[model samples]
Target: MFPYAAELIAYAAGAALLTAVGGRGLLLISGLGVAATLGVVGPLLARALRGAAAAPQPAPALT
Candidate 1:
């Protein structure tokens, strides 16, 4: 799976930069919202995938 967390962090950093350039509070809030959602979802998906990765999969027995 792609690193959604990294993408979200990039988006947040970009937004912060833009907000600073424009001195806009609304942009900051919007960026924060996007970052927060990404933070919540990325870990949840990673945890779900981690379980799958740890599951026992059928493997050929080497004789």
Candidate 2:
């Protein structure tokens, strides 16, 4: 959840900055920021999810 939220916030901020700047250089900068955010967040999210899935579970008792 944190990763997803962070990704969303980063993307929104990047978009807003790009719109406000309205220039080729800023566009490139904003694009790099977005890509970097995703590059970091994506692996963290994947690892967290994988860890959750790998957690131990108790076995069911038979009657």
Candidate 3:
């Protein structure tokens, strides 16, 4: 399951990069790919960062 998800992410990233590199003519597909990649990754990164930030800080030991 994780492998498949990673593959999908790879595919999207590749598509976005390809579109960015030399696909100015195909604006529609390139634009869509970029949007799709952002849509998928943006929220996941945000959630991960938020979770990291929300992790409980260790309490100081009283002397």
Candidate 4:
């Protein structure tokens, strides 16, 4: 779960910054790694974070 929204957003900003003033080739490789990492982790992170901000649920009484 992304408890810290600012921290989560910083990565994207940093990547954009890196791409903005960098040369080709190496930057492309770094970009691919970053994208690949995100592709792999993003969905799992979303699943784990699905109920992170939801209200607590009550348990049903067993008869």
The model with the greatest TM-score is: 2
Pairs that clash in candidate 4: none
Q: Write the per-residue lDDT of candidate 1 for residues 9-58, one digit (tens) a residue.
A: 98898777776766476577778999999999999999999999999989
How many clashing pairs in candidate 2? 0
In candidate 1, which residue pairs get closer than 3 Å at backbone N, Cα or C atoms, i.e. clash?
Answer: none
Evaluate candidate 1 by giving its C-alpha RMSD to the native, one decimal. Answer: 8.2
**What value does the lDDT take at residue 49 in candidate 2?**
98
lDDT of 2 at 35: 100
How do these models rank on TM-score, best leading?
2, 3, 1, 4
State the lDDT at 17 in candidate 2: 76
Candidate 3 residue lDDT tens string, 12-39: 9768767776556456666888999999
User: What lDDT does each candidate get?
Assistant: 0.85, 0.89, 0.85, 0.78
State how far residue 60 of model 2 sits from its true place (Å).
6.7
Report the C-alpha lDDT of model 2 over 1-63, residue by residue, as the tens digit: 999999999889867877887678687886898999999999999999999999999899999
Give Cα distance to truth, residue 58, candidate 2, Å.
4.5
What's every prediction's RMSD, in angstroms? 8.2, 7.0, 7.4, 9.2
How far in Å is the alpha carbon of 35 misplaced in model 3?
Answer: 0.0
